[model samples]
Target: MREEYRGEKGTTTTGFDLGRVMWVRKEPSHDGLIVPKAEYEQEREEYKGWIAKEIELRGVPGQLHFKFVRDTMRMNTDGVLMVVDSSDYAMIGDASAILAETIASFGNIPMEVIANKQDRNDAASPQEVASWLGVESATGTCAKDHESAKNALIRLLKKLE
Candidate 1:
């Protein structure tokens, strides 16, 4: 079980009781095992148990469950609490406005947006989208461009770090 990496990435409103998500960076110690602090350990264990139960409920294969957990853990540690959606996306009529409200509710952290296929007669801009969302407009990026996405993510992470 020790070798089994169980964790997840990204934010979710699902009833995944992680107790509390924490940011932990390994200290520059010469020790072999980088054991997490006692408090973080407890939270991690709780998160693991919750994830396992959810997987069981969904009747997913062990391998897939393992992947989900790993992704979640990664997100919990390294992912920023940001939502990505498009203005045209139906879930939120105006994705930017909805995102802004969500960010406000969650408390401010470095947020970024990748406006996919934004409508513009040369008037649509990243600033316009960011302004609508009430976030400091990040450089708008194209989802099809991998480098652009990476840059956007890096930009946000650096701010958080």
Candidate 2:
């Protein structure tokens, strides 16, 4: 995926806003399967899980927009994984405020913060990011390190569970 940023001209590098909203259909996958209602519901749940996994596997690139983030949270979200750039101290305050507002508006949902870009020389520490975000825990991650990224994701998922 291509990296997109919000430009000063109220435009984004990507044609559309990088934010994404995923919705899971509750309806059965097959119309003529003739399965029991309970069975169909179970299958639908499994399908939703599969879809979520697929999305995670095929990651998208884009900055999160407040509107889009709100819309996505309105869906059947089990948890939220917030990724922050540890090197961008200037944006941290604004981002933290928005995150706090979103959390308050949406109710207390499971959330985990990932302090990314640890490879940068000027990147803030995980503890510093956590403090700035008002989160008790934040996973440290270097995007270039596949193992570190994967481990951080796993830790967040574990917390969600």
Candidate 3:
């Protein structure tokens, strides 16, 4: 998180870039545990397209690689920085626990979450998210908003430091 840029305002610090993953919500059918088959299939195809696009943007070679466990999707990473956004779903099996477990499973790498449109919800706050993810710290940000996201990036970088 060291300052990597200089300007009239002085030094600017940047955060690491974590790979991105989009989580989609599945609609349930008659069975509470099961999502409607057609709806689920539609979402599946959409996400697959998204993953392919991300790999292309990254310019990765060979076929794109990924998997899902406990409703969370993972990218095949070989020790590279990754940033995961869970804005696609409202709540994924306890955000805090899921994030903690994900990071742990990913070898304790510095990970971040952007609570997209989080301000819309009266109940969920960044601090609440931090507490839930079992992370001592986290930033609440809207990815669509550049200014807010930039500030969040700074915080994430500082955490790395």
**For this target, which candidate reaches the highest lDDT against the unseen true structure?**
2
**Residues 98-143, model 1: lDDT tens digits:** 4544354445545556554433344346676566556666465654
What is the per-residue lDDT of model 3 for residues 1-161, given as tens digits with 9 covering 90 to 100?
A: 79766763544443443233222223211111222334445566654433121211131211122223322434654222223233434454444444555566777655556554554646366666555556565666664566676555444443444
lDDT of 2: 0.61
Q: Compared with the true structure, what per-residue lDDT tens digits does model 2 show for residues 113-159?
A: 88898999999999999988788978888857977765665454445
* Per-candidate alpha-carbon RMSD to the true structure: 14.8, 10.8, 20.3
Tell me the TM-score of each prediction against the true structure: 0.40, 0.58, 0.40
**lDDT scores in order:** 0.43, 0.61, 0.43
Q: How close is candidate 3 to the true structure, as a TM-score?
A: 0.40
By lDDT, is 1 or 2 better? Answer: 2
- Can you list the residue pairs that collide in candidate 2? none
User: Considering only N, C-alpha and C atoms within 3 Å, which residue pairs clash in candidate 3?
Assistant: 18-82, 18-83, 19-82, 19-83, 96-132, 96-133
Q: Which regions in candidate 2 have their CA more than 4 angstroms from the true location? A: 1-66
Count of clashing pairs, candidate 2 = 0
